[model samples]
Target: MMVEQVEVLVVGAGQAGIAMSEHLTRCAIPHLVVERSRIAERWRTGRWDALVANGPAWHDRFPGMEFAGDPEAFPGKEAVADYFVDYAAKIAAPIRCGVEVTAVRRNPNGAGFAVTTSAGDIVARHVVAATGPFQRPVIPQMVPHSAGLRQIHSADYRNPGQLPPGGVLVVGAGSSGAQIADELRQAGRQVVLSVGPHGRPPRRYRGRDFVWWLGVLNKWDAEAPPDTKHVTIAVSGAGGGKTVDFRRFAAEGITLVGRAEGFQDGVMHFAPDLAANLARGDADYLRVLDEADAWALRNGVALPTEPEARQIPPDPPCVTDPILSLDLAKEGITSILWATGYALDFGWLQLDAFDAKGRPRHQRGVSAEPGLYFLGLPWQARRGSAFIWGVWHDAKHVADHIAKLRGYLDYGAPAALEPL
Candidate 1:
């Protein structure tokens, strides 16, 4: 028996879920948004204190509301959380926080879903899995465990002071790993940054933020997801936005190492791919510069030239001849911060709407199984589909689909997402 019913049910009250509610309300759809914890809980808890939004303020906001402060400044983690909270309040979204959806199953007797939650069971005609990406933290299975070294995933990392008084080794070269390692080293701790496959995008180009360049070039909406999903971005928003230069880091004494490969008694081994990885990243940086310059020339957009935009140096000797192994005790490294990224977990979704790798199988978030949808997936619709502004567009598209299904309105042919 259904205790309650609604036209649409949105899961996870993060930016994606909240965006869904906004569009649903606009379409006059009767729905409710459910969150496992408070709205934007991850932003409030799962991030480091020193973290800032990866995108600039002007580019990463909803179309309706403006973020307070300088438009070019990157809002800190707390401010970003507050922005979502304020957006929810402004829309008067019908949201119920603390209602955790444990399982979702198709209604065997009808065209709906039977959802079991911490609050109560409810039947929804349409279910939107707006859980977003970054579902679960993933550490490599090969990472050895030892009581001597304090190990924690990036989600659990709060600050450099949270760790013991010793050197720190941050594994992975993504945004989170690089930021954390920089913090540790700035605090006078010996830090080793494990290099991996990463894209080095310049923070600024041609007197404008790189984000502006991406929008004008349609790189955000025009690009498609690559075959290898392991490539993480190397950029920083600490003091405004800046390129993540490993060469500069090496010059600054933040030792660069290869990907973490092995661990033994009080020791960790790395691959000899530091030079290769840096070379790959340098190539990526050059490619962006080349493309941006060409685009300007083609469009005849005469912008002020940025000098450092084309001044990336080759790898220094430190980056080329990196330490292949680390004896933790000998190096005085007492902490291992794993910024290894996340894995998808749809264990509660009792639907065959996923591929073999557990990635959602949906065409622009509309599942093959009718009435089921996914939102806020990375590259679900395009490169920008996972960003804050991108989520707004995706949610509106989904809401339009729901409205059209119930004869609310007609939705035209939107952009077709590529098949995964």
Candidate 2:
């Protein structure tokens, strides 16, 4: 087999990968970017039509290019994909597409890494794994055994047009679930959304975009002393708001259900949220929004508002009307959509240094494994590590640090790998 060598091998040419590539290029670092498919295909293929970004355009930019449109407006997935294509072209970021990196193994002597692809092997001293956290959608075993309803993960869902003719049950109350439920209800599908601890929607804070304020105030920016716990809370609480709120979903005729129980023959059963539990999802979200506002207040930052906030019509009720939970399958509920959260899959990575939860134990993007680094993870620096606009700040830091590493800084030769 022909051998290929590179000084630095950056995997996955999505937002994170592209950002790293740009940084490497600017530093005149010899590097090769390998992507499994067309760049940004994840956003192009995985998202829905009505799916504008969860946040504003200004908050979805990269290192060099700002999103081209109304700063306050949200761009669709296609627009994002197009932006990536143009950005890659503008930067002349070399990317080898259609090469799936199957395995990444550390050199036995602890020098570099071996990146095995379907086509061939790439050896490099420093390996940056930019394959983001949403690589795969996890479907719980509890969902598969549901007796009669056809079940599909939210990843498989493109739009309400693809849902079953019968009423649809959406599991999870995260951002994806809420948006899916809204779309389905708007499409005239009787929709039920299983509630979870979702982040709050900013009803109105100050007079500016909450996300913009977060960005300007450096809420998602990395700090000298990393606050992982604070980072997690910031991101998990209100980093990205759901496209639709419970009130609007309710007004749109979407049923807001409590957490799902085990599925029985064709019937998807749900546990009722107690009187106290009722509207808990909305309350939970509002609490987070309040917290965000309080954060701005405490920090003495001017709260910035969305430009179009006043223009957009008043939201429909957060809850859809006549949205009552009925037994699915038994009650002719034919389909289930799991909008549950996503999990990171480092199973193939085979790192022994992971935490008990299988997460990489690291400060920022530095994993315990030497020469192996991760960037663009959710809350990696702050709440912005995963956001397109926010990733650049983190990527710059990671790339700058990587560029200083002994092996990474060398532009002379690709690190050699021993015989497999």
Candidate 3:
């Protein structure tokens, strides 16, 4: 068994790992980035073929690297993956692709960590888990074990043609669910979208992208409310900056059902709160808009009075009857797409740093475990911590922390080091 030693080890060569590596290299920190697959594997293989980034290119950039293409346009999944590859090469990040880390545990002397990868073992003074947030798909336990139906997670779904030729029942009304339903319906397949509590932000507000407004309002740094559950935001770039509102799905002949409850006797039960869910999403969206408007007015920022020409009007009430259950075989729903988001998996890491909810206990990227850190997690430090543009900030902090511990000045420090 080959063994190597480094000052730092960064797992997963995605956006987060690459960003962390850049900072580590800048700090003259000896680090190795290991990935189970090629860089940006999720963006390259996990997403659907027609899927485009929810945010435009300008907003979907890393530190020191902006999209060279049209800033207003949203790049497709492949294009985004290619961008990551290019960025990794441009930064000369030390990455070992196709090298999976099987296990990570503290060293016997409590000095650092020992990472056991498929290739060999690596000992590092610091370990940064930059594996990203979406480690595993969150499929509900309510889904039935049916031999007649095909089930696929959003991460595995590539295109409408991959599924069997029949109706599709999307089990979540998040961005992925909405976009997939629309795409499947456009491909001449019937689609039933299960509604859930979501936020339907406009594609563009006041003649500017909604993301730009978010940045202006400083929402990215705003603290999330206490006891807030993750709410999926309904927005998409599949149709080139299109709004994936549930109201429009009803008008487009897509069956809108309530949240999936459970499955029994070849029937899938659902909650009878379709209207309430839609109303909640609408209300949440309006609340955000109101907040943005108020902030703009208070700051004296001029916003366009009229809506953009590309903005589509919200469709009127279409789904009225409360769909309580769906007869899977009878309705000809041959496939189920579970777009219920994802959960973090750190089973490989033998540590007590996780909370009751299995989330790592961290302040920013610094974890409870010394010499350990996490990056690319939703709201890790700010609302955009997991985002391409936001991860850089957290990376810089983690790099500085590691450098300080090792008696090295922060990267790019002056020659004359001041007193600590």
Best model per lDDT:
1
Off by over 4 Å in 1: 223-228, 408-420
Q: How far is each candidate from the true structure, as Cα RMSD in Å?
A: 4.8, 5.2, 4.6
Regarding lDDT, does 1 or 2 come out ahead?
1
- Model 1 over residues 189-213: C-alpha lDDT tens digits? 8988999888888888778777887
Task: Give TM-scores for every candidate, taking all chains together and pairing residue i with residue i.
Answer: 0.94, 0.82, 0.92
Candidate 3 error regions (>4 Å)? 225-227, 307-318, 408-420
Candidate 2 C-alpha lDDT tens digits along 314-366: 33332223223455655546788887656887665755547887777777787
Candidate 3 versus truth, CA RMSD in Å, comes to 4.6
Model 3, residue pairs in steric clash: none
Error of 2 at 171 (Å): 0.9
Best by TM-score: 1
Rank by lDDT, highest first. Answer: 1, 3, 2
Compared to the true structure, candidate 2 yields what TM-score?
A: 0.82
Task: List where candidate 2 sits over 4 angstroms from the true fold.
Answer: 144-146, 203-206, 216-218, 222-243, 274-325, 407-420
When 2 and 3 are scored with lDDT, the better candidate is 3
Residue-level lDDT of model 3, residues 364-399, one tens digit each, is 889999888999988888888878888888899899
